[model samples]
Target chain A: MTDLPIVLRFDDVSVRHSGSHVDAIHGCSLEMKEGEHVALLGLNGSGKTSLLMAAAGLLPHEGTIDVDGIRLENSSLAEVRRRIGFLFSTPEDQLLFPRVLDDVAFSLTTQGRKEGEAREESERMLEAMGVGALANAAPYELSFGQKMRVALSGALVHKPRLLLLDEPSGALDPPGKRALAALFAAHPSAMLIATHDLVFAERCCDRFILLEAGKVVRDTVQIGEITL
Target chain B: MTVPHAHPAHPLARLCGGAILLCGCLVADHTTVAGLIVLPAVALSALLLQRTRLTSMARLMLAGTLFYLPVVVLASPGVALKGLSAAIVGVATVSSLGPQALHDAIIRMPLPALVRLLVLQMVHQAEVLRRESVRIHQALVVRGGVDGIRGIWEFAKAIPVVWLPRVLFRADRVGMAMDMRGYGAIVPAARSVRWRGIDFGVVFGSLGVAVAAVWFSALVLI
Candidate 1:
């Protein structure tokens, strides 16, 4: 475990939105090793989302960030994205396609997979997520929990090495959260989950990192040791 | 929930029917009674078959009428009537076809990948905007932002200021999600839908209606 290679690295990364006087996340540095599950806990507006966005290269950042040894630069952005799966806080924002199956298969289709193959793989992923019956349904037709499951299927279907999930269990019931925790437990990828659900985070993550006022306040293996 | 297609026709067939109806509306001289009657008759028939929601249809009609109000004010009544008729036909055709059907048809069309992608994105973003607008409207109503007609007017006035920034932010988030998912690296493969007897019926039926309407308008003119 000690010899595991780093999956994600952030070196003094700072994110500042345009026209803003202050940084969203300032001097944020962290490392995630292969197959590690890390919980990113913070109060609202504490830059948890901003840090995840910066890692995904979705925001302009001051310092360097690396995914699977590849720097998050313009030239390598596409390649880096290939190795990462990002789940937006709002599932509706990411489920762009009309049909559930199509939305799940979109990642694979855009990666040049054949339609039949992509659909088949998407179906399998949906089944695993317990939303197989929803393949033909429209995204707008789904319940919040179902939508979250479908969105998670879409994120996981491509088998990305690093999973960046923002509030994955935000709208779930207790059973849904447990199901999601189980799914995360089974996944082989490294995950950086931004969440306020301490129980959920504790279930799925081995390490906890707390952010306060755009900076990492605590990093520890014990969840009970971190203060929100 | 599975959206039941109002008719069993394939999406492409429905699209073709819509195209014919639109063309007929554009070409037909709506000043004539026969020309004006043809489109509404065809559109109404289609809408009936599709079983579109009455409220949705009414909303679309109202929007269309409002859009041509300037024509009614500045131009001749006949010109405004023509514009309104065309608008009605356009709305009816789209409503009858449904958004999912339209999406399916466009993705399978022999168009440039970028054009298809742009159209798809526009359709998706429109839905997003509508949802966001509804949410904001509900929030305002619950927060006592709407007390009476005056409050309603104020809310309407604040739309551009309150809504635009949120829309822009959501757009950015959506764009980031797309980029992260590698949306443009390759053209997505559209699943092929087989044509049924109803599809043929729709296409031929629309063609016949369009041709007959044009011929009838010509005869009336003569």
Candidate 2:
């Protein structure tokens, strides 16, 4: 009978791959408010994507990434991951299940639901995301737009509290980019999207953080407060 | 405490029964050749499950058979003709069965074993092919050879050059895709969960049937 207070806070967090001399990121921190739409903008290799990955707990990092005041470490990661959904760039890489239904269903496997319940949930989510017909299609057969939609559904089906997306409009065309901005507007989950698409960053995100060389260059603009 | 399967209560039973059948048959070996005869029928059934265009499958089968004929002949030397015939029959059986039975068979298997199977059979084979090609290319590069197999001079010189980059490019793409999907990165931990006594009984019963099949098949065949 209590609401889960979902919060994500990063403090002095940096990720250095094992055996690498140069850190991917260095001493960068940000706190995401509940239900905030945040955009991460960076020149290539500025560690924006790395920061998002660390926040999602997809990669190991030093310092602390706190989810709702609890830091990411040990068995707590499972609980943290349960509350966060993540998508890596490249549909070719991220969407791997031979069939679309299976890809969506695979997201539910960890939740340990009955097959019927899982199937229903998967179908409902796909339909809601507007890729219902793709349930039987192969991931390779999908267009860039369709794959984006499928990946979104897979990330959202469990209804996670935080959604992390890397390069949401990287490969998309004009209409596709517009559609994605629309998708972002409709979603309820708190999100951190890392991208070089400035137009997309402007339209899709309410708060923008510009990153440069493993550090924040400017924390400017609140789209919700100011007109584009 | 709960499982992914809809009819969760009988999971171990189903797994035990299925494993007993497949492993029992594999161990039964040559004696289970009769069981293997059911392979074609099963392969054909896959067409139904996938709803494949039968004509397309037939074309693929014919092409596959032709390609396989020489390899089977070369591998089995003395009995090439006989073994090749048997192998052709074997492919037909497997093709008919489709992959559903195999899917069912695999579902019972432990997750690590399933992934290991994919890596060993699929990824490992790709790796070996690429490694061998790289070695051959290095040899050609060292001998002051013009690299390609285009326009005679360019073509011959290109053969050594293209294969490495082309194969490597594809592998990189596939590798990135797998990594994004959490392949080999997420390891499933084994947890102790209790099941009903019926689950235990069903599994044991499956094991018994498997033992009997192998024992009886050996006695009869020998």
Candidate 3:
């Protein structure tokens, strides 16, 4: 058997958006196995979020992103997208549907669900995330924490194989963070979290990778990094 | 009494509300159309009463209305009053909640049927406008700009790139989130929604008023 159980594999990835002088990230490679939780740590401008986005196939970057033997580069995005759950740091940007129900339902519908099925599934997902109460609420009316829950519910609605979170715990309070950590721990899907919130990275992710200049820097986080 | 928190609406409420709003605009008499003035007043009053601390939207709405009045007057003086009244009513009807809930209500309708509405085109106009404005507003929030500016130069600078990333980012997240949610994966199981007595009363009650108004308007004009 191969020595790796990587559910996700990135090789020699480099991304240069249209007219940028320097590539946003260059030559970054990593492997993540099933049930493996990984943290991406870096300061702003360190390319942490960009790398996560690339892995999630949200952006067009030159690299081989393979999820479960499916290479994202040449593979159909529809299929790749179904297998992945992605969230952005900016909750407002992440929540596209104005209505919480519609937003959550968007992911469900994308997976080829009929209207009725999509609605029910969206409701269930919202409930599981403990924000079902806000299911009919307006996106703009929600507080940042509530918005994050809605976004998370939207991400988890389809329950994809790979879960990608970008600083999910940022706007949350301590209790809220812990609640999210517990959810991550209990979730069956493999997770890759991009955050400067080391506390969250420590709690939700089992493995840690510090990214600098679009490259993997120090690999693995120590126990000292764990702080509630 | 403790104040009640705003909640997500029934799909019927959203669908009927939107339909009535649109139809009412097409047919309502001047007064009914004008009931909308109460909408902004209600919004301000509700905000005042609830006393939630956040950025206010009242001034923005006023400014928008003020900016458009002359153009609207110039175009259709007679319909202007009716149109203004109708708009006021529509706005008031939906406030105390936000756009997302109404959208969710729309989604709650059967998918095939909803798709058909868009295919018919006119419904898509309202749909697209809703999508566009919300998308733009979200972008403003994300870019950390567009918070009701005062300075002319700052406003000028903010005009071009205002809320672009937020709009794009929100658009991106919408799809990803929807897919993961498994929306439209299968026929949604039917869920029961019990309308309060008032809700039923509201529906039939509004229908009666609309019918009466239509008949009366036709009779009077003849």
Candidate 4:
């Protein structure tokens, strides 16, 4: 396990939102081994989202970040993003295509794959996520839980090495949460999930990193062993 | 999980039908009674075929007519009527065809790649804005910002102040998401839609209507 390659690394990173003077994430550092699932736990505005966004190269940050051994920089941004799958807190924002299948096929199509091939792969992914029946349905017609599953399908379709999820359990009911946990457990990609649901984190992740005011306050193998 | 239109008319057929109807209306003299009759008739026919609720259609017509009332006063009633008729037909065609179907058709059309992309992006941003507006409106209502006539007025006043910033922020986030997912790297291949017998009938029928309208207009002029 120690010899496994690092899938993600954030080295002394600080991030400030545009037009804001205060940093949302300040001097945070962490690393994840290949296929390791890490839960990021924090209060609202504790910079869990900022850290994830920074690692995805969505926000300008000081210091360095790496994905799949590739540095996150303007020139390397595309390559880095290609190696990571990002899920927003609101699934609506990520599911852009009118049809569910088209949305799932987008990343592959953009990578210059043939349309038929991309769609075939997307259909398979949707089937795996248990949303195969919704391939032709419009995004507006779906229930929240169904929409979440479709969005997850879209994220995972391209088969990236790492996943970055923000508040993934926010809209899910208990059963939906459990289903999501099971889905993550089955996927091989390393994940950095920013969430408030301790139970969800415990079910899917092997490590927990708690953030307080943009700093890593706790890093533990067992979340139950630590006091918040 | 089925699409809204279980057996939708082919998108090309819908597009051609709308275009033909619009052209027919535009070619006829604004003051001609036949043109006025035909325009509303075509719109009504489209609405009926789409199974649109009568109450909703009436509400839309009322709002649209009220919006063009200024044109009736400032320009001429005939010009206003023409504009209203065109708008009605446009709306009916869009409702019948569905935005997703329309989008698919437009992308597949023999247009330049940039133009297709521009249309797609515009449609997407419009949807985003609409969704945000609905959310903001609901929030306002739930928070007691809406109660009576005065509340409605205040809510209307607050829209620009509240909605614009939120929509802009959301648009930025959505754009970032798109970029991260490699949106513009390559043009997506168009999906093929099955055409039916009704599709051919629609195109031919529209052409016939357009031709008859043009002939009728010429006869009236003579």
Candidate 5:
């Protein structure tokens, strides 16, 4: 355990929708080491989101899930959340603040930093994301690509240990998708990205974990070997 | 992106001023004075905020006045003045404060984090819906097959069918996003309000106006 420095561990974990008969994910087990970037590939409703949600502690599971050796449970939810950054498939979902800057600064403020300091850091993050010009604009006013970049900035501003990205390439233009992949390449945190964009996943991820009907049908370290 | 600073007045001051204007409109015997005072105030605020392009405001007021024009022609002078003043004041207040100011003020309110977050999102959702509606209309226009009244009918029919599904899907995604970000676990963070002397003065001044309006109306009634 010490040699590999596992950042995430899922052991026999399963999740079902509240009123549904089928489990979204069933008996899935996976391990991610520090600096690992894994692509979660699946069709719609195949539990890619559910798996990411479970890792982020957003959904309850039957089996144990741990992040950086910390168990995800009611008592540890806040700590778990603080250590992970989750980006939604739609930028609209995550860019909730009135101003783009405020949205980017949200995590820092929630972590008890002063507003000024948070804003300063948020500005730096937006600038780094190449969206500094959109700081004061409402999220609704931004283009889809701009909003995505801003959402990415918000997720990464606090520098969490792990990132859970849901379809980061979904709405982006080709150039935008390429830039996002490059940005992910530079990020230091471990990441598990759920996406159907195979080309995009190949660009940024070193491993592919494929799901089918809520079960892990394929998990391969060799990206070239996998096809969905 | 740079965050826009709060209004010149503190959030509390703006709230109190809004309340005062609302009360004055409610009690004043004649709409003319209230309209005269409030209209200029709104215009001044708009000018300060640099939102001076008044096309929408003008269009709305024109439509409202046209709707009430029959009343103006047939009713007594007092009745006409009342209708026009009410419309003017209402539009002026809404346009001046707008959603952004109210949003800023709402964030400063000592409400629960979840409530504030919901309110903010609701405001944004309204904008999103409006934008989506416009996009749908634009798409209809680009199709170039539908035209005139037929185009209007088709556009109207298509909006709900096309927009609703997308909105619903987006809503689910948003809810999941909020959950992953730990939205309800703790109160959401808001910009801290710093009330300066001017903020206090503005609040008090609004109170004074409210009191004076009450007195003037009372004496006139007597």
Candidate 6:
């Protein structure tokens, strides 16, 4: 962890949805260093998704978010998005294209990669996710667990510098969870994952940040402070 | 060896065919032309029927006819039958296109990004709602949750209160997801458009039919 670069920073960030009096996230500050694995933990409606979305530039917020030293603003939104891969909580939401391969290759194509190259990379990514055979299959045809794996492949296909995953282990079976743990171990990019699966988090994350009511209530190094 | 047959008409060609027949149905004045439209519509419907839910399509056509009957009859008794026939042809054309083909047509069209996105989302959410509704109804049947008239009423009420909100929420998520992948607000990279010889053929054929229909309707029907 010595002299590692900062990949993501949130400084006094606050977000409020339209017509809502309360901020979804208020005055939050956080940092994720290069190659770091951090777990974001909180109860439902605790602004976990909001934090990740803000980091991904999906949600507009007050204050500053710097991705790889570039401030996240309207002008830099596209560049920021190019640097961070966001995996939604619901796999169905993320898997947009008709076929699994098409969905996985969507980001690559959007980023100006040729179709053939994007498709080859997408196939390789799906192979890593253990769903290579699902390339031709329609997303609607896959089971929930299969969809989750396919969605993960899509998120990682572009190979961004930072990854923001919301509930990475939702609907995964034991084997699928193990594959995900292996993926986290093998992934070279920094990751900030919001998840309820403490057991799975324990296997991959080195730090934990707990949020309560849109505030960071606890931040701990996962080395010796907590078992999960 | 047997002669290699030509590939089936591309989805775009079928889409153009459907559009032409639908337009003809719209402008058709004489019973003969309207009657002629039924053959192609029926042929297309027969081809597409195998790919879709026949029972649902049949039910929808029946409902449409019932709803259109009174208004059509009020205008002219002779036109009532033709109006019903037109409605059936329209339904059959749509049914034959299938959702996937329709999606392909929209994607290939040089439409504005927002319009394309709206159409895509509408189709996706409709499909999702349809599958979920089927599952819900099946569950209701298995659990004996719906009985007779009351059950139907309950199901109808459940659609608006439960499923609609769920679909809307899903649509919102899909929108955010699209944004994260560099699709929203940003003009996406252009997909390659391949216009085939068959597409040109279809266009020419459609133009001929359109001109003939207009001439026939003008000189004979009026």
Maximum-DockQ candidate: 1
Tens-digit per-residue lDDT, B174-219, candidate 2: 4643433344433222224466876666566546655665565455
Ranking by lDDT: 1, 4, 5, 6, 3, 2
Candidate number of the best lDDT = 1
Task: Tell me each candidate's RMSD, in Å, in order.
Answer: 3.4, 10.2, 8.2, 3.8, 5.6, 5.0
User: What fraction of the correct interface contacts does each predicted structure contain?
Assistant: 0.71, 0.16, 0.34, 0.63, 0.58, 0.50
Query: How many clashes (backbone atoms < 3 Å, residues ≥3 apart in a chain or on different chains) does model 4 have?
Result: 0
Q: Write the per-residue lDDT of candidate 5 for residues B1-222, one digit (tens) a residue.
A: 112333566654565555555465456455344443443343233233323246655775677667777876797544554455445544444345555665787666667777876877776666667777777777887796777788778877886788788788778777777766656554545556778887777666655655665455444321
**Which 10-residue window in model 3 chain A sums to the lowest lDDT?**
A219-228
Candidate 2 overall lDDT versus native? 0.61
Query: Relative to the true structure, how large is the alpha-carbon lDDT of every model?
Result: 0.82, 0.61, 0.63, 0.80, 0.74, 0.74
Candidate 6 lands at a TM-score of 0.83
Q: Candidate 3 regions off by >4 Å?
A: A1-4, A73-75, A96-141, A182-186, A221-228, B1-68, B72-76, B82-86, B92-101, B104-222
DockQ (Cα-based) for each candidate: 0.65, 0.14, 0.20, 0.58, 0.42, 0.44
Give the poorly placed runs of model 6, Cα more than 4 Å off.
Answer: A223-228, B1-7, B27-60, B67-94, B97-102, B110-118, B139-144, B147-152, B184-211, B218-222
Interface RMSD of each: 1.4, 7.0, 6.2, 1.4, 2.3, 2.7
| lDDT of residue B140 for candidate 5 | 86
lDDT of 1 by residue, B140-168 (tens): 77787575676666668768899888888
Ranking by DockQ: 1, 4, 6, 5, 3, 2
Error of model 3, residue A89, in angstroms: 1.1
- Where model 4 places Cα greater than 4 Å from the true spot, the runs are B1-8, B19-59, B75-79, B124-155, B193-222
What overall lDDT, based on C-alpha atoms, would model 5 receive against the true structure? 0.74
Clashing pairs in 4: none
By summed lDDT, the worst window of 10 consecutive residues in model 5 chain B runs over B43-52
lDDT preference between candidates 1 and 5, better one: 1
Top model number, TM-score: 1
- CA shift at B17, candidate 4, in angstroms? 3.5
Q: What TM-score would each prediction reach against the true structure?
A: 0.87, 0.62, 0.63, 0.84, 0.76, 0.83
> What is the C-alpha lDDT profile of model 6 across A64-105, one tens digit per residue?
999999999999888889988888888888776656887788
